[model samples]
Target: MFGFSIQKLLFTVAVIAAVWYGFKWVGRMKKVREREARERLRRQAGNGGGGGTGESGESGAGGSVSGVAEEMVECPACGAFVAATGAKSCGKEECPFLG
Candidate 1:
């Protein structure tokens, strides 16, 4: 009878552990879903409610018909491509795009 009681106690403990871990897993999944939703909302907000086109004067995968694409200049300091719209530098204080 004592051995049987020990078995029942262990089973109850195992079930409690399972429930705790299950709740933790569910909480992690909920956090991941919330983060993804927030990321999507931030991206949509940054798009400025445009028709997903070049209406905002930004170049995209599809060619823009409203305006000519601004030429991308190679930053001599960092060798990074940046727009040539009065950009004296690539916004990097350490390495300004002099060239």
Candidate 2:
């Protein structure tokens, strides 16, 4: 009877340990996913801001302007040339840019 009780206790301990380890593993995975998500967001933010400089003196410092004539696109509403990636209406209330 004592040996049977010992076996039951061991089985209970094993099951508890397995559950604890599973929880720990899940928590660790969640932390890793959160860290990876944060890294992706940081990379996206950096890319969105357009970092670095060109071979010439231009550092691409202008807001929303790529400074490259080839990359510029004309806005149909206001006929204003803006960065192709950022081309939009002139943002004038009287212009179609507002919509």
Candidate 3:
């Protein structure tokens, strides 16, 4: 009787392992589908001319240098933002944003 019970226990263990592996496979498939859907959406929006990154305008009295990032520095004196390369803290010594 004990030997018969042991055989049945072994069969149950095998069945449980198979079910766990099957569920794991299904989860992986679902994740792949979600990733593809997001990529497609990104591509469609990009082709529709929704935005421009890495873009700059010609430099004049008030223009960003061509092909250069417009860097702005925050003033610690008055909280005003200014261009990093040519910015002074408003020359206001009393300003909290002074830096």
Candidate 3 has an lDDT of: 0.70
Runs in model 1 lying further than 4 Å from the true structure: 49-99
Comparing 1 and 3 by lDDT, which wins? 1
> Which pairs clash (backbone N, Cα, C closer than 3 Å) in model 1?
none
How would you encode candidate 3's per-residue C-alpha lDDT over 1-99 as one tens digit per residue?
Answer: 999999999999999999999999999999999999987785664454435663222225575444334588777767888877756667778654434
Candidate 2, residues 9-68: lDDT per residue as tens digits?
Answer: 999999999999999999999999999999778556556446465233335476464333
Give lDDT tens digits, candidate 1, residues 1-99.
999999999999999999999999999999999999997885776675456564443345586443444677877767887788766665666666553
Question: Considering summed lDDT, which 10 consecutive residues are worst modelled in model 2?
Answer: 49-58
Q: lDDT score, residue 43, model 2? A: 59
TM-scores of the models, in the order given:
0.48, 0.50, 0.46
Displacement of the residue 23 alpha carbon in candidate 2, Å: 0.6
Q: Runs in model 3 with CA error above 4 Å?
A: 50-99
- Of candidate 1, the 10-residue stretch with the lowest lDDT total is 52-61
| Weakest lDDT window of 10 consecutive positions for candidate 3 | 50-59
